[model samples]
Target chain A: MRSRTEKTLIYALLIAGTVTFLFPLWWMVAVSLKTPEAAQAATVRGGIASLVPTDPQWHNYPDALMQMGSVRWTGFLDALANSVVVTILATAGTALSSSLVGMAFARMRFRGSRPMFLVMLGTMMLPAQVTMIPLFILFRNLGWIDTFLPLVVPAFFGNAFFIFMYRQFIAQIPEALLEAARLDGQGWFGIWWRVILPLTRPVTAITAVFTFIFTWNDFLAPLIYLQSDDQATLSVALNSFRNQYGGITKVNLLMAASLTTMVPCILLFLAAQKQFIEGLGKGAVKG
Target chain B: MATIELNCVSKTYTGDVRAVREATLAFRDGEFIVLVGPSGCGKSTLLRMIAGLEAISGGTVAIGGRVVNELPPKDRDVAMVFQNYALYPHMTVEKNMAFGLLRRRKHGGISGLLFHRAERRAELAAIDRKVLDTARTLGIEPLLARLPRALSGGQRQRVALGRALVREPQVFLFDEPLSNLDARLRIEMRAEIRELHRRTKASMVYVTHDQEEAMTLADRMVVMKFGVVQQFGTPGECYARPANRFVAGFVGTPVMNFIEGRVDGGAFVAADMRVTLPAARWPRMPAGPATLGVRPDQLRVLYRADAGASSTAADGASVAATVRSIERLGDRMDVAVMIGGTRMTARIENDDRLVEGGSVLVHIGLGAAHLFASGEDGARLGDAHDAG
Candidate 1:
């Protein structure tokens, strides 16, 4: 009987915590539907009561959309396109390049390999901001400023962390596999392409997902690199909407756009959540 | 059918750790030669060198009378079954067996028209037939469609064996292939491999740490220590007459017992035990001190010293000792007897009456005792008994 009471109390606390966590999302949607006055009232009251608009103004979405851009459904639509392109390209480039580099580092032996690997690992700790300005200047000199080139091309070389992850994952594969392939009259390239690549799907998928998410949600890079109104990413465009609209901002349209930007990332995570979690758990064993 | 020869092959690592010293061995066509030793004994290293997996640091490895030291593993035409079986986990058994053939066909290495679809299908069908036949031969026909993960340990091992056999390579290299199985499974696999060898009669070089596997399988076993070949001979020769103390201690199950003793008037004397030596040649010595190597099976534990000698038991030579421990292993009991501050183990039949802490006279069969020179370099001073 006491255990039943304890279970009930535990469930009650869990439900309360969940509601508390979800309250922000509910408020965002509620205010998005309400007029600016109702939003202010909601902010003031900080409860569900203020969510009901004194006078619902649905035109706020069109106004916010027009102010951002008419290129698509909303300003968020253009930003979504930009995010999709960058994320897909970055994920593909990072996954392929990192896996290649990782395979070499993990399996191949060459002259000065130890020192070279050390230098590669050493690049991980160096901050990205340290090289940010220099990279911008280099790209500017190369006539790449105010363009997506600044955001996309450099990722083809791969980041050190992803490469490190791939290396650790690939190293766990038995060397005997490669030996067997060799005895089957396979060249080094044959072994790498046919055996290693085929066996490394899990690691590749995890790396691709992480790279996609990182590229998708990145606001700072787009903010610094993209300048034009048309070229601006969804993240930068959202920030610009807040700047231009000020107190008269459409809560619904802004919330809608913000929510839309998060959809792809959430969907991707849902699709590969099992593989991602399993990969992480496997990595934890090694760690 | 290939005769492989290793001419003074040596493998030394960058850290100056020599995994295989200057070792020269040759295997005749269709002979099963086993490389047997403890861990870190360079048997695996030597096998790898022969397979072209390891770079030959010093000398040449000739496969089928062709120098192959510089060739890659693919060109060596040697199929090796790894200790862990090394079956490709992602591939089914059929695909695993057909991989080498498919690779060969694609590369035009195996004379066939690559663009002819019907001909390719025929070739694929031929490969399938071969795979099925090999699997059937190994009694793993039902496992052809199964992945490695779904198969039992013995089944996976058979697949590995089938994979090697399917290629029909010039030589087969087995690196501790049956070490992963349980005792019963190991015995079964050992018999299967032995029968397979008899059927195919392919030149094979097997590496294993199990002495029984080595003795039972190989036409000749090469015993190694510290990257050097200690002895290479038939099982009977190695067991009946080990060249040195290391080989003597390494081959037997319980290992041979060594009692530190000194030679005195054609007999060896330790603290309170003495054993008369048979007629044999001895090394040039001052007759001061020596060590007697006796196998456990040679030492007989008896409750009474004057029991009627059985035909299997040697005629005389018995010594008294207090029983230290008795381990009954069903058919036989391994009895460790304490004699004069040194414990010597004896394998007696299970029917023998013996108990721990009870004093029993152990018959030291002089016919099988080996004597070595005392000191750091325990050279084979002489065999106490002559097999001739």
Candidate 2:
């Protein structure tokens, strides 16, 4: 047991850590409400006043959203729609393919399975940058550039890390359960669909959530593949906010746009984390 | 019900590690056969082979007089209840029991496969009836609507049994199904399993490491060691006349006592102690390093001073020993005594005559003793040979 003083000290440290982590979020909301001139003035003054707004400009969100519709970039709603489309497709694709490959690797036995799994794990060592050029060329040859194909098609092929995670998760399910299913007249696909899939819901949800976050936050792929502004995702649009024509403009609107863009992800994670992680977990415990 | 037969079946893994070797067993239709041994003794492997969950490395497996080596578990006409009670946790008990039946049935009958909605509904209702009836028979009717996680250990076990029973297969394979339960629950489930076996004609091939479980449940038990089938016979035959030293030591409770000695001039002698062998049962003494095995129940305790007054078996030997310890088990007690340099146990009714650190006479009736070679795999000799 911790002493009273020790407990107080630990709590104080934790509160400090939380505040440090949340400071950027607070800064984003505060700056989003400030006038552009006040933001610049506070930046020049360099004090605690810079951490907060002097006079709030409540119309910056509407103004930023309206400016997002100009010929220079896709509007906020367009980017949001693109993000949703890519994230949902990518998440579903990844969940299905990853769990299938993982279950095959973990449960089914065949020649070269060991070497194949090791090679799959080996691919996790390489960063996306290593394959970026080749993938771009491949997409170009297939006439997939400036389309969602480059963004969503690769997810269906299965991700190595997600497959490995799913494999580890599915391996913990008892072999007897699978055998029992087989004895009950289920073929391999039937067992996977009826038995393995339901047992691995928690892992599938986790993989989907991760894929959703990764596709939403991904900037390079969309920036490189999506040539037209209408097809641009939020990350590419956000990048265009500061680096367009080599000058950061309308810092207040940028903050407002950034805050609004992150809202769906935060709300999604908060809404889904509990049901995915906790709801189906109690069934796994054997009596 | 099917008569299952294995003809010199074996399982060899990579690196030439054999899990089961040349096991040949034949079960009559509706016979409850048990495969009994210690861990890694290939009992469960043999059971799995019969269930078609494992690939046969050698020989043929026949169910209902038809070879099924190439068949998968789904087509093998067998149902297995696992040691862990492999219930589908995400489903209700009714669904778990009905899942297999639902998958196998197409409409209600062969004539209804292409028929309309009424046939499908009737088929589903039939499945529901089978699941509910099996649940009722297993006394798990109330738990049908509940998930496996909501059940107690025994309840989950019953549900697992029900799932297998609902399928109504030709053979029922149980791989240590009751081992996970507590002692009392294990005994109760054992009895229930026995009763269920009696009520059904399906041949049951059960695998368990517990010798008692094997003995009590088997119509004929197969004793295995190091992946080899050592003996196969009725439980009474295996217990009374084991085939080898390992079987004798493994089959009985409190363990059979082995005293290393040799027969000299038709009498057994070890260090300063000597025991008389029953000449009527032995007739002739084979000359070799001998180990005499006696069950704890076979040894009678006598007071050192009153040893001459008792009517000891004519062919038996009496030895003076110091009482080492006494473990009282309600109506009976296990008394450990050291005769010369060797220690032996005597199980008798609890009596006031014996005390710790006291002196007593241990009597061994050679008529009931087993003689074997002096090693781990020694062959049984003398009167205790297999009577059949």
Best by lDDT: 2
lDDT of 1: 0.81
**C-alpha local distance difference test of each model:** 0.81, 0.86
Output DockQ, candidate 1. 0.37
Worst 10 residues of 2 chain B by lDDT: B306-315
Cα lDDT of model 2 by residue, B1-388, tens digit: 9999899999999999999999888899999999999999999989998888889999999999999999999999999999999998889999999988988877645556556668788889999988888888988999889998888889989998999899999999999999889999999999999999999867999999999999999999999998999999999988888888999999989888888988777677776567667666666887668889999998888876754332334667777778999999999999998877888989998888888988778887665678888888798875624432
lDDT (10s digit) by residue, model 1, range A114-161: 898889889897898998999888988999878888888978897788
Model 2, position A183, has a per-residue lDDT of 94
Q: What is the C-alpha lDDT profile of model 2 across A92-137, one tens digit per residue?
A: 9998889899989999999999999999999999988999999999
Model 2: how far residue A88 lies from native, Å: 0.9
Q: Can you tell me which runs of candidate 1 are displaced by over 4 Å?
A: A1-17, A31-47, A50-82, A108-122, A146-148, A185-202, A223-251, A284-287, B107-124, B262-288, B297-342, B347-363, B375-377, B381-388
Global Cα RMSD, each model: 4.8, 3.9
DockQ metric, candidate 2 = 0.62
